[model samples]
Target: MNIEEYRLYCLSKKGVTESIPFSKLPNVLVFKVKGKMFTATDINTFDSFSIKCEPETIEELRLQYDALEEPPYFSKKHWSRVVVDGSISDKILYEWLDISYRLVVAKLTKKERLELEHL
Candidate 1:
């Protein structure tokens, strides 16, 4: 998918907000839920994006998908850089994005999660 499609998909999730938080990398857009980041991508070059992954399954995913690789700026064990080179299908990409969102949501405080549910 293209950048607009990716951005819209992320924004469609409940309580998700987008921001360009890094001054050094102004083109990099981060998508967060309740102020905690779940995924991010460079708007100028939507070739890839980073998403949180379960540490237990990160290695397996990397091994299974050639498009998945170690993220440049995130914990290797908890995040995966997904190359948007069309090697993977959009359906699978959306599923991985959903998993990332859910993982971040699962870590929210009880009150935050409740707030998110109401959004």
Candidate 2:
């Protein structure tokens, strides 16, 4: 998928926000919910986007898809860097992204979830 499509999809979720929060890399954009990060990528190139993933399934994912890899900057067991190549369809990407988003949302404190509900 294109950068705009990815951005829109992430923003479409409730209480999600995007920002360039990296100090050294000003063009890297991060998507967060309840102040916790879920995804991030290079704003200009869109070469790759990362998401929090279940540690148990990360190994299977990396093996199943050549494009799915451990991000250099994230915990290898809990985050994946999905290369924005045409090999993986947009539909599949969106589904995985939704899963990642929910995983992060699920980890939020009860009060944080209630706060997100009001957003």
Candidate 3:
């Protein structure tokens, strides 16, 4: 999918807020919920999107998908860069995004989760 489609899908998630956390990179869009980031990518050039992932599952994910790779900017153990090439199915990308969102939410404190629920 293209950048607009991807952006819309990411924003559609409940309590998700889009922001550019760094003033130096205004084109980068960080998607977060309850102040915790789940995914992020450059809006100006939709080359890839990085998602927070389970450390144990990263290797398997890299082997399973040709379009996924280690992100240059994120910790290799906790994030995977998913290329926007047409080779990967859009459904799979969305699924991964959902997984990332859930993973971040799962780490939140009970009070944070309760706050997120109301958002």
Best prediction by TM-score: 1
Q: Per-residue CA lDDT of candidate 2, range 1-119, in tens?
A: 99999999999999999999889989999999978999999988999999999999999989999999989999998899999988999998999899889999999999988988887
Residues 63-115 of candidate 3: C-alpha lDDT, one tens digit per residue: 98988999998899999999998888988889999999999999999998898
Each model's Cα RMSD: 0.6, 0.9, 1.1
- The number of clashing residue pairs in each candidate reads 0, 0, 0
Off by more than 4 A, model 3: none
How well is each residue in 13-119 modelled by candidate 1, as lDDT tens digits? 99999999999999999999999999999998899999999999999989999999999899998999999999999999999999999999999999999998888
Per-prediction TM-score: 0.98, 0.96, 0.93
Q: How much is 117 displaced in model 2, in angstroms?
A: 3.0
Better candidate number, 2 or 3, judged by lDDT: 2
- The CA lDDT of each predicted structure is 0.96, 0.93, 0.91
Model 2: per-residue Cα lDDT at residue 99: 88
Clashing pairs in 2: none
Following a full C-alpha superposition, what root-mean-square deviation does model 1 have from the true structure?
0.6
Residue 72, candidate 3: Cα error in Å is 0.8
lDDT minimum window of 10 residues, candidate 1: 110-119
